[model samples]
Target: MFKNIVRNIFLEAENANVKKYVKQISGADKLDPIIVIKPNPTWVANYGWIAYNNAMDQFAIYNLNNNQRRDKNSRCIFHFRDIQELHTVQDGICNRNLIPNGFHVPQGLQANIALGTNNPVPIGRAYLVINLEIKKLEFLEDKKFFYVD
Candidate 1:
């Protein structure tokens, strides 16, 4: 069925070699700031994005170059109180932002500015993972790339 095909794609996308290549291209030591969500009950997905928060303190901050704080106010800021705010914002804007096919970029992948700062301008990516359990005889085809910048 279609579920099988999707599962195969996901498997290939997350293979060992693919992960190694992604790591090299992204230059990320570790995959942090990973978001896992269960949007449905049939399939699970995994995504990777850049982390902007201090790993030790678990605090998120805007990566800026200078002292200018004007842009900081306009860009999305994340805090303990803004968890849901971030999720909602991401859900709302996930579909509009899609990365063009090039280099190691895979199909059905997207990116957006999850958070920003005024100083140097933030340059990072975010990741997402989904888990689903399929049951019964069903044909689920609702697939779209979702992520926050």
Candidate 2:
């Protein structure tokens, strides 16, 4: 489950920074992503690791960011989708979960409904997939607005 799944995940990150780094090293982007027993997230950008996975806690949970070299040190190349398989059912809520009960999604984003997906591992949890930089992760309060597809 681990090896095959990770191999597939790496394939999904074909555009990962390691590929670009390897290309710059010796013109080869084929260096397979190395998986350490337990990786330190802070050391990721410094060591140029394509991905660094910290172990899951009691509930067995983790998250990943997109592929980008945001700072001068470590470039984050994590994708939250590939590793975790979200199997929650959206009963017309995820489409507009961010809006107030009486409100609705804007007409412009209505056509893009096909782009949304369910929450993470557990079902019925309100994991807002917003479009802003969240300094810290916290549960959404009632009647508040957030950006979601």
Cα lDDT tens digits for candidate 1, 1-149: 32343343344444554444333323211221223121211111112122211121121222223553311221212222233534543443323222211012122232323222111211222223222222222222322223222
lDDT of each: 0.26, 0.26
Displacement of residue 51 (Cα, Å) in model 2 is 15
Sequence-dependent TM-score of model 1: 0.20
Top candidate when judged by TM-score against the true structure: 1
Among all windows of ten consecutive residues in candidate 1, which has the lowest summed lDDT?
Answer: 39-48
Q: Give the poorly placed runs of model 1, Cα more than 4 Å off.
A: 1-71, 74-77, 96-105, 108-123, 127-149
Candidate 2's TM-score: 0.16
For model 2, what is the C-alpha lDDT against the true structure? 0.26
